[model samples]
Target: MAELKEARVPDIGDDKDVPVIELLVQPGDTVKKDQGLVTLESDKATMEVPAPFDGIVRELKVKIGDELSEGSVVALIEPAAAAPAGDAKPVAPPPQPSPASGGGSEVAAKAAIPATPAPATAAPTAAVVETPTRSPPVAFDADALMPGKVPHASPAVRLFARELGVDLAQLSGSARAGRITKEDVQAFVKAALAGGGAPRASGGGGGLDLIPWPKVDFAKFGAIESKPLSRIQKLSGANLARNWAMIPHVTQHDDADITEMEAFRKKGEENKDTKVTPLVFLIKAVVAALKKYPNFNASLDGDNLVLKQYFHIGIAVDTPDGLVVPVIRDADRKGLLELAKELGEISAKARDKKLSSADMQGGCFSISSLGGIGGTGFTPIINAPEVAILGVSRSAMKPVWNGKEFAPRLVLPMSLSYDHRVIDGAAAARFTAYLAQVLGDLRRLLL
Candidate 1:
């Protein structure tokens, strides 16, 4: 009789109570040795717990949303006997996060170095003759993927097309049974380029003035596969593109000394009615700053500047689908605990795909916090209609000279990106400085 084996979470460096984001296997599934059982996501990385040996899963020890750490049991397995010598190896290498890619599966990560474009070669006659009439490129359409009418292609091929911004509906596949492949997409792009079908510059009606996006056959260099962008990605991609192109953005960088505040937060963490997070404090501090600098809380509407009296703050939540900013209404009226509770609820709703349009609209300012995720600083894009957005990165202890001698201080990095048309550099600098001051002393929020 095969002995029962426990599949436990391996050493997941320094991450405690990481949430189980996905389950890769079921209790009844027959899993190979080293096959992933469950996926855990921490602030720094996402990793999967693997089966210790080839086995039939008897029971899952953990479920989604369960907090797990190193040595935490994931599943119970009944080990399988040794395989025959002539059998092919069934062990799959564990997926490792690609250092170069911001965040995605290993298969989604494109080559770090650009694969040299396949030399100019004569295309298959069908590929050249079947090119679809290229539409005049304008702003990226959020619904351009045309979910209503999908093309005949593998998920990997579809993903490749999406990455290249190639509309699959238009392409004619040369493959068997009218199936579109990566090669087909590549050929369509080459034909479009050779035919001078590149999109016209934004604000310029003249068509085909810009160089077409590059077409490359990644398979020539090495192994490759594609992963489709989430639905949120499709929508957000178009909006982000429009915002980046239309807005004249300026970023102001500053640091906040939060040594005392951090200490206070930790001390109060155990006593808070609803768990108080750094983000709760940020929301309060931002409200205070907005009150002092009311212009930052206003939006530009055609020729008018609409100043909002009620404080609604948009918190950029990183959901598995994509990034969604849900508004916390009347943030000025809510206490820290209330804000914290609401933040938690809204974030949960975002991740669960439960947020409505109203949940995202009517924001005076937006905050994108990457503090939980490790980052020194990043210029966050200003969510449109909101004139400014605050980006918070991970805090670190650093030596700071306090009048006489250097003292170790916890410093939080902030990047404030503002619409240059609405906010001047001096005002932007002043706004950040005041925000930092408020964050340094949470007491300032009371005033």
Candidate 2:
């Protein structure tokens, strides 16, 4: 006889009450061990919770958009005879302090699966069961209580709270089950500030006082409607808001005379398929510069600074809905032609909305090119964690001194926006200057 078992939410990391972004499986479906059962999206990353054992999903305890904590019953599985006992894989307990990922105390790098292979036979008579577990008594401590209660807030919200150092308990929860919603936190923050409460903490402990949410008078307009933002759109909005509000942004602009680069590209005498564009040369140049100054490719880790050696360059591709940055990992290792080919493929996939979540995951630096759209120069927001963002603009013909006389030369305008807290103005300017010099010289790019 097959034993029916509960499939509880495993320890994702240190976070509690993480929001379920998607449900990958349903009741009556046969799932292989380690197959993704549901996707939990925390602030830092989206993680897939896998089936611990081979089984048929008997019942689903949670649906899409549900917020779950550790030990929360996600589903019921009719485990095959070979499946291990419940004690063998006990559900991980709720975490005390959430990690950057906001899942649990133990960061589950990857989901664990039962070693035994699942049988092909299906069982149609399996029954589902649900049992309530006792909740831990509320903590009196301020810090512990705040995070424990605000688990449903997006990563940006949590980060905002952390930066503000405001106790979430002080705020009235407006979400279902008394979960602290972003708006609730913002309102509380605004009230606190207006009444002269202590300033919100910085980094992960502070809150942004409410900036009256955008509203529309549907009654006045008559028969108006609105729809919820998509997951990508929501995430984007949160990230942009957090970055813009928190980080001190400084933009430095410069122009690169790409006359030599263009002439070399027009000649096209080297290779047939390897069509080099200004962006490709810029990419190579940026990679070379990063090799010299690794600090520009780093991320902020609490009080300490993190410098990255690997150069995973993210190229921003415009889509119908929004912008997606698909990364070209280890850009320094790839030649100009190879880089161009990969860029073309990835950009096409992004525009077609065919790029997977994994395609947009990691990047040490980002390039937002408006050159294709005919922009002169625009300051682009830094894709957070990365300290800087490079913007590429259209190359135009402008008069420049050619040693003896003034001559019209093709020049490209570039903008660099860096985090003022981490990168100094001089360093940013030098980095942009280095990028400009590299783009101007075609020989170095080819070599």
Candidate 3:
């Protein structure tokens, strides 16, 4: 007798209610262990749920486009019966053809068919065998073809194809096993318009050719107009509002003179292969300062304050959609060059939407730099749970008093925003001052 078992969804990290995107199997299908059963898409990443054991799928409890949480029953499977005693592993039966094809009966009946007798007329002309005339191959029509069984492509590719009014079904996919690739879609769109099959429009070209100009009726809503927010946008808005309302934010401002640091960096760095950045110097300074003041490298946990011995700093990266913070683990231990390299790599990944949830979590402190955007000073919002955040602003040539006369020197503005509930105003100011001193000295960064 075979035992029935329920296949429950596995723990997909920290995300609880992940949405189910697709179902790979159906009822009564034989599945092997470790085979992908369903795809769960969270805000961070998409993960596949695999079969727990080798068995025949008896029933599927859920369908595609369903939202699933942890411990949700995905399917029911019946275990294959155990082989008797010392018998070898049971072999799977061969697949049967459709009943319309007459499967086993057609094969047996073919042998009993009598041969056709030749007619005896005027020497019978050697009984010419005529082959049936083949019909012309069907022209590729966009409406006639059905959607391919290949997995869906990225949303950007799909949107591009839609905007061009290019029917994906008409194009021959050149990806692995005929999957539709982004390059393939782009090439197809270019070729199709070039061939005069469709009219092409310039970037800002007027008339109906551009995006087919959607019809608008102004009389429908003359008084008011509103639109709903997307899921991601809605979540971001809520998070931002919560952070502003709940956290008691306090901002501290200071300036760093990079005169000695700039001179030191320019000394032998011209001939060296490795190029150094100001951000790298600042990161080293922040890590070193964290050692002296561990409270600055801490987070607020519930009513209790959690002080983290490990130094993980999150670098804020601004993308087209929204802001993302990718954490750099063990910043205190990493060298200046290593820290710069990791920061560049993680920031690029975050901008490209390739960062996982793990990369965003466990950040003890955060640094948001707007200096590159020509901002002299701006107070950055504190990333939630983190007690403090550092903001780097633009460096400018400002007048400084020398022993005899005033001279021009470069000055960098820095801002520190802290959770006032946990960190005092004086502590924030002192921390900012220390950071400014480190940036000014530069040699202490090496220590």
Candidate 4:
């Protein structure tokens, strides 16, 4: 003989009049001791009412959205097989499993319980077996959630994240007890769309169901030889890919009249042993421009902007292996002649593979010069952690109208690439204009 029992809601704090958000089982379904029978949601959290003993569900006492309270009868359960008529005494329900130790065993025990689950109570696709409840409504500890490490959020919040296709694990919740909220999900979605941090749950395709890159047999076309990429190329290539993919890049193109600066630079190149390149003067001007517009020399740290006080400019040097930016520390402190000498030494070291890791660290801004090679203009990727980069193109004599008459002047084309998250378009334009002014009249650099 089987004894009949009711699965009543357990002691869930002071919360009352909570609603049944999900019903896990119905009449005729078999459940194990401590298996979740109904999912209840309070304003603050979500939890499930568990079966008190292994039994067959006889009748549902409540429906979805019904208000519930502690000790409220949820379902009528028929106890497991009886031992003759006496049955020794009524067997105690299985002990509640500790979240850490019994996560795996809980699955096994629930599996043993017959699962003739009724139609999905939550959604047509929603599974309603022994409800895989992650945490009880009162259990604010995120670790108590179900499965192996799903981020801690309420059932409703989890559903919200799923609808937005945002992964909860990637987000650090702002709510108390590290609880993820609907607002957190919305913010993450916005950030992903803006190209700042963490990607969408759809494999970061930016909502595109893109096809994989095709693989081809190159030797089939003609004779071919394959060579492995150098270590620097491989490393920098990955960083470039990540930066371009995650950072919203915007480039502002402008021309600088470096005529006077060029004349001064050529005068110093007459020395065979010591050569002063245009880059030395440009470096000095860049430092001054940074002082004028501090935002240009800042990085995006989460929601805050980190403004750097010191100017450690990075110079992008092209080598046979790949492109590497060796930083010049304290550029504000070094004079034009000293900068030229240091640049020469570092360029030589970079070419010979003699530059140490220390020689390439701690940069506030970066400059990539394609002037020597030849290009009207080009966009340089911001060397990350540094907000902006200046790309210097070839200098040409372009005729400019000096109010009254057109005069030919040596014009240097430069493009400023910056992380749009930190510096706006207007600010970037101003920074470039100031740089061009300082370069045209090297005297302004003194200010």
lDDT of each: 0.76, 0.72, 0.69, 0.78
lDDT of 2: 0.72
Instruction: Rank candidates, lDDT, best first.
Output: 4, 1, 2, 3
Regarding lDDT, does 1 or 4 come out ahead? 4
lDDT of 4: 0.78
Error of 1 at 285 (Å): 0.6
lDDT of 1 at 342: 94
- Name the regions of candidate 1 deviating beyond 4 angstroms: 1-209
Query: Which TM-score value belongs to model 4?
Result: 0.60
Model 1: which ten-residue window has the lowest total lDDT? Answer: 107-116
Q: Model 4 Cα RMSD, Å?
A: 12.7
What residue runs in model 2 are displaced by over 4 Å at the alpha carbon? 1-206, 218-230, 269-274, 445-447
Q: Can you write out model 4's per-residue Cα lDDT over 106-215, one digit (the tens) per residue?
A: 43343222233335454311332345435324424434223233565667887676556566767788998787889988887777656676553444454332345578
Clashing pairs in 3: none
Q: Give the TM-score of candidate 2.
A: 0.54
Q: By TM-score, highest first, what's the ranking?
A: 4, 1, 2, 3
If scored against the real structure, what TM-score would every candidate get? 0.54, 0.54, 0.48, 0.60
Better of 1 and 2 by TM-score: 1
Clash number for every model?
A: 0, 22, 0, 2
